[model samples]
Target: MSIWRSYPRSLKVLLLAMLVNSTGMAFLWPLHTIYITQGMGKTLSEAGFVMMLHSAAEIIGSFLGGYLYDRIRGKRTLLLAVLSSACFIFIISIGLSWPVYILMMILLGLGIGTIFPPIYALAGSIWKEGGRKSFNLIYLVLNFGVAIGTALGGIVAQFSFQYVFWVNGFTYLLFIFIVWRALDEPDPVYEAAQKKALDPRPKKEFRPLQSFYSLLILCLGFMFCWVTYIQWQTSISTYIHLLGFPLSSYSALWTINGLLILLGQPLLQWFMDRVKSPVKWQLLSGVIFFILTFALLSQNQSYGGFVTGMVIMTIGEILIFPAVPAIADRLAPLDRRGMYQGLVSGAANVGRTIGPLLGGLLFDGFGPLVLLYSCIFICGFALICFGTYQRLQYIQKEVSTVKVNK
Candidate 1:
């Protein structure tokens, strides 16, 4: 497609690598709760706890990944990340046991989390002018990988989860190959920034503290949105199983999610092109849709109802996820880009860390209705956070202008 070719060649290569990585990860993620609950004979609560640990690990990985990007650059950081992920995942394929599975999942999370910030940072670096288009392409390829992986993952799972693990591991190996061969170190963007920073003349001062404060506000909102969103992967998947629907049915929801995102991109891009304050509007509208999704889920108990919810949720997802990173990219200083992006990723991981444990507690204590309602309330909080993030940035800009005038 013309859209694909419009990106820089290196970015295209990075995108391909991302696609491979996401596909591998997808093979296991959609089925994680199910594997723990049914395959390992564990309770939902236990599965939730394990997922919590996994996400907590990701928080560390996300931060580390971003930090390393600024220091070491993308190519080396990527190779380090994927190599660890592959080793852990391969061990999982062979051992396929209980306590070991937990350890491996946490380690895998670290590796996987490390992989993303660089991919995103590289995309931004490779095509700075692409704006939302840059991050959106990464998101698109991500879901496209999800679509392929989840579909085949479901089939592979029916045969043996071991095969799923092996397939996932193999993909990571493939990802390593792509990254080692394709991506270059000390990229043009980084080199250019380094040259500018190293210049002898005085430089215009940047608002590091204010920008950082804004990023914190943004991350809070991002974390909350993820907190609610992640329930679908944890609690809701378990609930679907409890309702006696097959694993494939649950997997189909993600499949639909990815497919809708892929197929609906043209329409989404068209609307984005026409919209005012597109990032702001996209996030606000997305939170509203998330609320609608949970509301619908609370009332509807049928398979068709779940299908409908996934469609609604995917729309919100398409709008929100890419915009958050784009906002971070906008807010970051030249040298601190990776650190800022890492914080954003870490925020999302924090939500993922909390969601499963909280959802599990709610599901275990009060039941599914309470869990669904709670998610809707969390979405409401996320809306507040998003609004506050915008407000802070606006105020900071106004303050800066006044000082400049004085």
Candidate 2:
């Protein structure tokens, strides 16, 4: 099928909004922790705690967003999230007090939470005709936003913290207007059909418990991977600084990771589609990431080593990240897509919450090498879990075939 076939007007509008929203978020990405710790004079532990709180709020918000999307209009829920986010941004820019910052984190988490489920639902519902291609396109564009946001956020942070908030607020405002103008709610027939498909009373009842257990196993691996990624963003700069690099290199690192992701995601997607089993690619990526991270610890002071590590990690990320939603699509009940997406997102959030705090503690105590070793161990455990999951899936498939023949 032609790639452009998925580019209907509504999908186009949603993608554009995502681009703008992401660009705005990029302004905040590199600065949020820096501003709290350095600019506002909080301790590393304090900053980590705040981030943990933010993640907790995000977990709540994501699940709530998913539930709302299933029951209410998608557009209304999105608008609420955007507006609420704008309010938090205003508070962050103005108050800058500790209590206010904590409150804003919770509110902002809720605001951001509103976006994921509705956006995924919109993509799945609208691009029903495009199938896997549609899902791939959405993943590609979302990562594109992430790459741009992280890259630009580093550049912008070099200027001023306030500039980041200003850009973030304005982008959100623009996102609200764009979404309002361009998108339409899903058709009622489409909604009803989705609900029917997910109904548990069908010949083959939807197995929520089984799916939940499967996701729990998958999430254990995801938690480890995400913790490693978050640590790279949060503590790697400090580690490099201690190794005698200039402070400015921090931004450069973020820029490098973002640029690689921007360039790599589409190519990886194309390659994975041609490969027979996504599980193989997922396992391969995890192994690559583990090795590169180990190598990075051995050459702590070498700029070349850092850059090589970043490249290797980015390749692994390209393979692993998009495969997550694809796996969710396969595992989820047809009608409960939003819930499945929420669970996946929530698992990542849990990882994000723990990663920074744990990394910070390790970096401060035993140093960077210890942190790297911890990451390698966690990832190794994740790979073992993935192996178990693969074996179980194989058995399940064989059993299904036998039943079908009977």
Candidate 3:
């Protein structure tokens, strides 16, 4: 409570907006592959292809949002993104045939993608001192929304998926209203940060270009992480259904994921606080867990096995997801914060774009064992990438020191 009260007004609103946004998204996203596969009688491969397209669109949107935030500022850019998303989502709620449904989903991805960079950028801008705490708080709230939304979405979907679509659309409308009312105010803090960012001088101690190289490397690992992670939503969801688990049971997995994340925050914070080079350790250790997740999945087929795998996966998610943005925040030049954040988001989307298609094809062609083993192999590469990333950062610092001594 004390910590919550300590946040700046804009950050508080940003957190609220993120919560609302993610909750709405959760209502539909967990069900997307399910709907396409069963409701429309599409094959898993077809559903994967559609999801890939949607994620590709989101990549474009992430870039556009970052550029817009850096250029026009967040207020107007956010309004445009939210308004467009709401329109697309409303149309989706109204019902459509296959091809049309596909197109609307892609467009909705664009809108949703644009919303994130600005929110993340603004969180850093508003509370410059908050550092990892700010990103973690945002992440915490996001999962809370997921927890609430997924649980409710499962129930609502039991009755009718039409209502699920409507609920998602309504939340976007609510987000628009919040932005209009709360975010329109003149923010002196953000304005001051913007002005500082415009300064031509570089911080000699910090190398923006080199740091960005590191960020790109980190993002590659992030991309791989998402590739493995997204299987739960894509192939794994369908696989569970084939195993005879109910849709509500599948959705409950996500609910458990979200709830566990919420419950585990304090422990994560403690671990982080005590760790040396926390973010690096977080990435490395998380990838290890990701590998373990798939390894377990390859062997087990029961409900208990799935739950245990999810629990392991959730721990990796807790370690990895929030830390990536926090690292990006640290590395970004004040002027390029939005751009850096965008790249991070875009990288994740790239993984998402690939994951579904790859997982589906692997599952269809080979089987679940092959799919799970493939994920484990990819996660090994992720571990290597993050490890190499830390090494590069260390080398960059040494080079900078040499230049300073000269």
Candidate 4:
């Protein structure tokens, strides 16, 4: 309670909205592919393709949302996104049939995708000094929503999946209302940056292309990270179901995953604060966790093994996800902040789009072992890319310092 009020007023409001949005979203994500495969009478490959489409829409939405963040510079952009999400979700509640549901999923993806970057940008806007803390808090509460929603969703699903639809829709309605009323405040930093853009003299000296290159490498690595990460939702979830576990059991793993994140964030934050270069440690430690988790999956036969892998993966997630946007914030020039954040987000979605499609094909053509091995390989590649990006950043900084001294 005291901690809630300690944040900027806008940050507090946004966290609540994040909570609602995540809760609603959690109800669907764990079920998406399974619903298409088992309930809709679609094949696993078809389900993967549908999930890919959802992520593809998200990639478009993310970049567009970033552009709007720079252009519109207020809560209206957010309102538009939430409104679109709610509308699509409402249509989904009316009918859970085949092609209609797929269309709704893709539209909902666009709407949902549109919401993230602006929210992230707004977090950076409201909490300037403690920017990392703001992103972590938002992420922490987002998982609270996931933990609560998945726990309840697992139980509710025992009776009717339709009820899940209605409840998720209701949460979105609540999110829309909250964003409309409480989140209308202008972001001071964003406004200042927009005004500064009018005079090109100062910004012209800064190497925008160098900044872009750094972001491109960082996002490319991060995208592979997501590609490997999301197999839990797509391939792994379907794999669990095929083993004859009920949806409740499959969903419980998510409940556990969310709960573990809740426990992990604070402890990890304490440790991160002690490190000199937290971002470097984040990527280094994250790829190790990635390697280990995928290896576990290749041999995993029990729920308990999945549980252990999920906990390790959650630790890696805490190290990585909240920091990615913050790193982009550090890399971006004032004028390009929104676009950099958007591109990072877009890269993540692109990874999500490709992950399940590739995983499904691998699982169908070869086996789960093949998919797991491929993810491990990609994680190795991500590590090399991230390390190179960091070295490049160091060079960029040295060049800038020498220029300033002259």
lDDT of each: 0.85, 0.73, 0.85, 0.81
Look at candidate 3 and tell me the lDDT of residue 93.
Answer: 75
Per-residue C-alpha lDDT of model 3 across residues 182-223, encoded as one tens digit per residue = 974336466556546655455665577778888899999999
Model 2: per-residue Cα lDDT over 1-406, one tens digit each:
5766537778878888888887787678557778998889999778767877877898888887777776775788788889889878977887467888888888898778768767776776766554455566666677677777776776777887777888899999999999888788678687567545655354333255456567667767777778887877677777888888886776676667777776766676667667754665565565667657666765666887877777788777766666665566556655576777777677778788888778889989998888888887778877776666455555665776688899
Collision count for each candidate, in order:
0, 0, 0, 0
Clashing pairs in 3: none
lDDT by residue (205-254, candidate 4, tens digit) is 44677778878988998999999998997788888888887878876777
Please list the residue runs of candidate 1 whose C-alpha ends up more than 4 Å from where it truly belongs after superposition.
31-48, 96-101, 157-161, 185-206, 238-251, 299-304
Error of 2 at 82 (Å): 1.5
lDDT of 1 by residue, 245-296 (tens): 9988997887788788998865886678786555877888899999999999
| Model 4, position 3: C-alpha lDDT score | 70
All models, RMSD in angstroms: 3.5, 3.7, 3.4, 3.8
- Model 4: residues >4 Å from true position, as ranges? 33-46, 96-100, 154-162, 184-204, 237-252, 296-304, 397-406
Model 1 Cα shift for residue 277 (angstroms): 4.0
Name every residue pair that clashes in candidate 4.
none
Whole-structure CA lDDT of model 2: 0.73
